[model samples]
Target chain A: MSVLFFELAMTAYLVVAVLFMVYLAGRSETLTRACQVGTVVGFLFHSLALGQQWIAGGGFPVTNQFEAASFFSWTLVLVFLVIDVRYKSHVLGAFVVPLAFLSVLSAAFLRGNVQTIDPGLRGLGLTLHTSLILLGATAFCLSFAAGIMYLIQMRLLKSKHFNALYHHLPPLNACDWLIGRGVLVGFPLTTLGILSGAVGAKFVWGSYWDFSPKQNLSALIWAYYLVMLVGRYTLGIRAKRAAYMAVLGFVAVALSFVGLDALMGETRHF
Target chain B: MNLIVVGLSHKTAPVEVRERLAFKATQLGEVCRQVTDQSAADEVMILSTCNRVEVYAVAPNVDDGFATVSAFLSRCADGMDVKALGPHLYHYPGNDAIGHMFRVASSLDSMVLGEPQILGQFKDAFEAALNAKSTGMVLNKIAKKAISVAKRVRTETKIAENAVSISYAAVELARKVFADLHHQRVMLLGAGEMAELALRHLISAGVREVVLSTRTTENAHKLAEALCAEGGPPVRVVPFADYAAILPEVDIVLCSTGAPDYVIGPKQVSAALRARGHRPMFLIDISVPRNIDPATAHVGDAYVYDIDDLQSVVEANLEERQAEARKAMVIIDEEVDTTARWIRSLEVVPTITALKGHAEAIARGEVERVLNRLPNLGEKERKLIEGLGPAIINKLLHNPLSSLRKEAQERGGRDMVETTRKLFALPDEGAAGDAPAGGDDE
Candidate 1:
């Protein structure tokens, strides 16, 4: 039942992504509302799917690549819902929802890779640690999407030619505010999650810092964000430059979160 | 139903003729009632705007319908020459009238193509007719469909997406550049007519602060007073010599001076850009000889759109709207066909009723005759026989009835209605028009 719900949500998200893309090109209000409905329905089923897994197995599901991918994509949907509802910019979904679709589809590809739930992943601390990290990933994706929007809008503003998207997309100041809000919340959550993960690791493996591939990658992601925040705070890096840095930082974080897991085969990484 | 439209619009009549024929809005309800009482049209509506004066009606007879509306218009414009107005009058009957309604509602017939004001005017006319009890089922249905068709044309086409006028184009460009214009400040260069016009648009858009400068301060004050009553944006007058000094604090610059030489230069724009932190600024130079240096646009975030540029934008927008208007016409054609089908389908209802009535009467008589000849028929079976007779008759008639309805939905469905009435041997009273009327006959 959980898998069925997951697949249904994945299909809905796929349709939503396509709908949003078409809506951007067509600038149809009907299609825009349909996209919002699709996103909400997909989110509802995704929540049910994740809830069913925890109810059936008695714990949070992040034991394998499939679970990890699905869980992260669900978090991304939650973030999109918040942004879409709060900002009321249908144009933002056109840029951000494709990433959600890709992540969920990639989870579908990793279907056979579902390993048994590791005992180390069952504790409350481990669940909290991973959930916080997923939330942070959600914030980073939003920031990254806003950054891309900012750059495109800037380029269009510089050139004096515009499409419908240019008219509908939020102004550069709004994009910067979104990124700033993302960093403000995401930085602290990521920091605490990493620290909590270290504590959970010590409790399970008798070590606080292992310098494993995952740890190293996570540290690199954290350091890059730290430098960006510091630059924003101290050096007064605002608007376009800050937007570019956000895109770059999010790329590194995505690589660390998704790519590092496959490279480190024997090293247990979440 | 015979729907007729007798009207004169900007396409056919001059403004002088239109003004002479238009109805007063305050007396619209009374005039609408008069038309309903005077004409053979069962339902009546009068649409009178600045560009057109039209009367739409659903009439029992098209000839009387046109005569009544024409006489009403002619009588209303008592002092005008009927001979001069005769050439400008346009009368359409039946489906052609419906198509005209669709076109007018969709802004195809508007002087400024795809303008939204006509639909609102139509709604007002519809409401006036409704208040006068002059619109019945046919006109009511058509009015609703006309509104929906207009809405579809707006959303489904790009007809109203871009601005078509120079001042409106400037305002639209400002909207594209700034997320919120309510907080922005505007500086007006010289009090040319175009400058005042652009200022009106800006002020209406919620521009809070406006610095108006001209060689004549009194003219600036007059323009400012015309724009604001009280407790609005303070339109302060600036000396023409110091207008350039205040450029750094303003977000938009509207230059429409008569000066042949450039009033704003690249150096000044560069200084303003630095003070404004390189923020986006719109410079609309609507002057004929051009008041701003073209090189001023070279500065980062300083957008210079001259009069010719704005006119070119308007032309491009007009071209786009023309293309979308073609698409809208296609939509309107489909709607017109749908509406025509709906009108034709109304004919089938009475025919089907008469057919069912005739068949049921025959079935009842045959069942009574059978019951009367039976010797020892049980009471329950006799009752069952009586009920089964009408059931069988209805079942047998269902196929032909539904087929007639389906034919009524198709092209040339009017012929199908006529043929059905003749073949079924049903009474032909109200089988064609079917508009509601009080009579001794059902």
Candidate 2:
């Protein structure tokens, strides 16, 4: 049942991504409206799929790559819509929804079928830890998209060349604001999640500071976001410089997210 | 009924002759009344713009209406050669008249093609004619259809998309950037004729707040005072150094100065973009040595269009309008066909009204005789019997009425209408259309 819902959501996101790209290509209002409607419908279906997975496991169904990726994409869409409305930069959707689509699409291929819930996962602490980490990751994903747009806009400005995309992209100031918001919000959530996980580790493995690969990656992710915040606020680094830092941070986040699953064989983040 | 248009325009008449024949609005009511009082036309409207003077009328007979209007036109401008004016005065009758009107209202017949002023002029003429009690159902229907045709030509075609003038082009591009100009603020970075012209267009386009900033405070104050006196949004004078400081709240910056260096740089705009919360800003640099930095176009959300860019936009727009005018012709043809069919349907109105009246008279006579023979009938039974007569009459006439309407839409609809009118003994004067019940919506 969860797999059926997951496929349905993937189809909706695919439609949204295609329509948004078309809207950008031609500046068509009809296609823009269609893309907006598709994103909203896809968001609803993605939630239903997450709910089905949760019911299947009788908990927060974030125990594998498929489940975590699905939740991550859903949170990205939610944050993107908020930023899009607040900034009045609807063109950002053309850049953001594709990121959401790719994550959910990759989830469909992963081993996402429901499995027996481990007794170690049966608690509020682990549930809170996983949900917060996925949400924080979604915020960082948005920062990555904004960072890419900022660099493109920066090149256009520096080269003194004008094109359709140069005009359509949000002002460089808005991109900077987007990156700042992601770090400012994502940093605290990630901190709490890491702390909660270490606390839960004491109950599951009887050690607060385990040398597991997942723990090491989480710490690395936390340190990177901390440096980004300090570089922006204290060092007075912002705009293009801050955007570059965000891209680097996003790369680190991605490696630990998908690369760990590929390189380490497994992670207790499940 | 007959439709006729008699006028002199920029096409055939020289400007001098047009001015001579033009009727000033002050005397328009009196002149329109004189023509209508002569009973030369059933309905009359006068459109007297600087480019043309036209009279649209519904007449009892085309020939007599033509004579009366031609004499009126000749008398409007005394001392002008009536014979010389003869060659200038042109006339269109029947469907040709409607086709001419639709084209004129849609700006196809304008001296400046795709210009919007003619539609407003036509509407003002229509309202004047209505106020003078000179137009009725047919003329009202024609006027309303013409307005819609003009509107469709504007929207469905790209005829009005690009601005034709330099200042207007800047305003048009700004409109494209920001959909609503009412809430947008404008800042003029320098003092020059180009800035003044662009400012005028922006004010007319609905930008209500303006700031004038220049290197010299006195010059800025002088321009600001002059602009405020010109009847627009209040113009505030700001120091030149404050341009970047005030840039955050402004939605548009019109820069035209004799400066050798860039007045607004990318860094300044980047800072403003951040301060303004990333709202899009339109920078129109019309000076020869451009005032705003060209690199600022790369700023996220800042759209820069220089003088060259605006000129290219105008050139491209002219070509677009030329392409769109062909499409507008198709729309005009459709409007003409629709109006012709409606007039054809109206041609059969007298026959229907006459036939119904004739049938009802006979129905009433027979029902009265039968009721007198059955005086013991109950009230409900009496009412039922009375209702039966009209019901039977209506049923008997339904087939013929519908067929008559169908024939009105065919190739020989006018002939079908004429034959029906003769068979029913109805007059060609359109008696039913002039009746109170036949009046169009108020």
Candidate 3:
């Protein structure tokens, strides 16, 4: 049942992505409305899939690579829907929906035998650690999308292209605001996630600071966002530079979450 | 019924001629009523704007309608007659007229393609016609359909999305940099006609404040007073030497001065960006020798556009509007076909009804004559004979009636209606006079 819902959600996201592309090209209100409806429908099916998996596995569904990718995409879509409604910025979906779709597509390919959670790892601290970190990652993904838009818009302004892409994009200030908002919201959540993981690490491994690959990488991701936040608020490093930083920070986060776990065979995160 | 449009637009008439022929808003109703009364038109609408003056009407005969409307316009002109206005007038009949109305409403026929004012003028014209009682079922339906088509084009295409002039281009660029200009400040360096025009555009865009600076303090104070008198955001005059100190607080800088060398350069702009915490700044240099340094554009978050650059932007935007106009034309074409089909169907309705009525009358008369001769026949037998005549008539007319309806939805449906009427020798009921029951008003 979980697999069925996941497939259904993936199909909806694919449709939503295609509709957003057409909406960007044509700029028709009807197409925008269709994209919105498709996004909402996909989000509902994704939630159902995650809920089914959690009930079946008797824990949150972020244990394996497949479940982690699926959970990340679900949170990304959740954040996108919130921003979309709050700002009425449906144009942002053109950049973000495809990313979400790719995330789910990778999850589908990484699907393997479902594994039940270990009894020792089933606690509130572990759940908080996983959920907060995934949610923070989702927020950073939003910043990545905003940064890409900001760079494209800035180039158009600089080069005086004023092409269709330039006309369709939000203002440079709006893009910068999105980048700031993502980091502002994601930084604290990530800090809390890392702290919870530290406390949970002591209970599971009898150590508060192990310097494991995952622990080191998580701290690295946290510190990268910390610099971005501080630079934006105090040091006055913003606009183009901030956009570049947001994009690079997301790259680090993605590497820490996926590449480190896959390449380093001894990571205790598995 | 035939739909016809007659008059001249910027494409066909000079401004002098258009102005002379244009009707006042207060006179639109009276003029529409005059056309309907003096001509063969059953309905009339007059759209009079600075760019175009056109008459939309429904008439029984296109030729008569065209001639009468032409004569009416010639007489309405201030000092022109039929011969003087003849070359300027254009008349479109049938579906061409409907297509022309859709194009005009959608701004495809505008002097500035994709301009927004034409649609509002069109709606006002229709309203005037409605007030004058000069519009009937056909005009009402066509006008409403045109309005909706205009709205559809606006939403589906980016025709009106860009700035097509220099001053507006500056505003458009400023909007691209800042999310909202309502909180931003504008600094006007020096004073010139184009500079003031751009300043007015920015003010209307909701800039919070304006600071004027010039080489001469008296000129600056005079300009500041003039701008303040217009009742917008507060205007302050800063000395020419101190303008650099005010750069950090300004988001948009407009420079148009007679100075030979560059006034604002890369160094000053970079320093300002630093002081403003790297906020974006838009610099527009409209002077001939370029008052702002071009190298400032290389500074982070600083956009420098000279006069030539602004002109190029306008040209590019115009080209974009043209591309969007082509898309709008496609939408207009589809709507024209749909509206033409609806009108065709309307044309065939009366003919179909008349044909059926004519066949039924013949069948009833023949049945009555046969019944009179067979008086000894039983009542049930008489009823069977009566039913047989009507049944044969229904069977014989079914194919032709259904085909007439099918043909009415096509391009050449009017010919089919005429042929059907002639074959049946039915009375020619003017299609315009026979308004179908439940004819919608709008």
Interface RMSD of each: 3.7, 7.5, 1.0
Q: Supply the DockQ value of model 1.
A: 0.14
The residue-by-residue lDDT of candidate 2 on A1-270, one tens digit each, is 777877787898888888777776652345666776788888888889899888877778777678888889888888777766676667778777888888887777776453434766668887788888888887787788888878887676444344456556665666777888888888998888888888888888888886778678779879988888876766555666678888888888878877886788673544
lDDT of 1 by residue, A30-49 (tens): 78889989999999999999
Point out where model 1 deviates above 4 Å: A1-19, A29-70, A101-133, A194-236, A255-270, B16-44, B63-84, B126-162, B211-215, B234-249, B259-279, B288-304, B307-442
Q: Please report the candidate that would top TM-score against the real structure.
A: 3
lDDT of 3 by residue, A1-270 (tens): 998999999999999999888877753557888888999999999999999999987878887668888999988888888888998888899888898899999889778543445768768887788888888988899999999999999999999877667877899999999999999999998999888888998899888888887788788888888989998877776899889999999988888876886688653563
Question: Which 10 consecutive residues of model 2 chain B have the lowest summed lDDT?
Answer: B433-442
Per-residue lDDT, model 3, residue A188, is 93
Model-by-model lDDT, in order? 0.82, 0.80, 0.88
Pairs of residues at least 3 apart in sequence or in different chains that clash in candidate 1: none
List, residue by residue over B50-134, the lDDT tens digit for candidate 3. 9999999999899999999999999999799999999999999988999999999999999899999999999999999999999
Candidate 2: TM-score of chain A is 0.92
Angstrom error at residue B276, model 1: 4.6
**Model 3 CA lDDT for position B372:** 94
DockQ of all models, two decimals each: 0.14, 0.19, 0.64
